[model samples]
Target: MTLNPNLRLRRAARIIVLDPEGRALMFRYDVPGRPPFWVTAGGECEPGESFDAAARRELLEETGIIADPGEEIARLTPEFITVEGEPVQADERFYLVRVSEARIDTSRHTALEQRLMTQHRWFTRAELADWPEAVFPESIVTMIEQQERAR
Candidate 1:
C-alpha cells in the first residue's frame, strides 16, 4: 500500500539506543490504531522540546531507559498501510544514542494501551536482522549496517 502523494504527513523522530554489545533497545506495541511493530523509542517533538529532548523523553517513557543523545544517524519517511489498509504517512528522523542504564517500570508508560510490551529487552544486531517479517522497521536494519561498517 502506498501513501497518497497529496497527503500531508507530519514529522517525528526516533532514537536507536545502543548498548556496548551493539544491542538496540526498542519498543513493541500492539495497539488497535497503530501497527503491531517494534520501533525505536521516540515520538513527535513536543512544543519547546528539541528533537533530542523528545527522543530522550520517549525513551524514558516507553522503556524506562535513559541515554545521552548521540548523533543523527539516518532519516526516512517511509509510508505504511494501516491495519485497515489505509495509507498512513510519517516523516521519521533516526538518531543514535548510547545508553547508560535501562530498567522496566510499567508505571512510566501510561499513554500506551498496548499489552504486548510492558518490558524491554536487548537485541543484537544480528538478532534484529533475523526478526520475523514486518516485526521491525527497516531503518533499524540500516542503522545496524552503518554501525557494522563503522566498527
Candidate 2:
C-alpha cells in the first residue's frame, strides 16, 4: 500500500498479553465500512501520556484486564488505509505484558463508535498462524514467530 505524504503517521502501542497457558489475547474488530480484522490489546497514544501508560490504559479499557507491561518485544510500522480509503499509518510499539488474569468486560470502553468488536479470544501461536489472510500484519506475525522461537 502506498502511503500518502500529506497524511500523518501516528504512534500506537500494542500489547502481546500472555497468560500461563501461552495464549495471547486477541479481538476481532468489525469496522462498519471496512473489512473485519483482528488485533492485539492496544490503542493510539493519548496526549501527554507515555506510551507505556497508553498501552496499559488501552488494554484495561478494551479488555478490562490488568497487566504489568514487560520489556519491549518488537517494533513495527503497520500501514493501512482507513475505512474511507484515506492513507493512514501506525508506528506500532509491541510490548510483552504479563497479566494475572483475563477479562472480557467492555464496560469502560468509549471508542466503540465506528467498530464493533464481535468476539474476543485467547489464541496460541499455532492458532494465530492458522488465521485467514490479512487478519494481522506480516510484521506482527514475524515478531510473534521470533518470540516463539526464543521461548
Candidates in order have lDDT scores of: 0.66, 0.72
Itemize residue pairs with steric clashes in candidate 2. Answer: none
Which tens-of-lDDT digit does each residue in 4-113 have in candidate 2?
46666767788887777777788787777677778887877987777788888887887777776666687777677754465667677788775666556777766562
- Candidate 1, residues 1-151, lDDT tens digits: the string is 3555775564567878777777887766665765456777777677676667777787677666666566667767777653344565766667777665544444576544345464456778777888773445665867777867886
Question: What TM-score does candidate 1 get on C-alpha atoms?
Answer: 0.73
Worst 10 residues of 2 by lDDT: 133-142
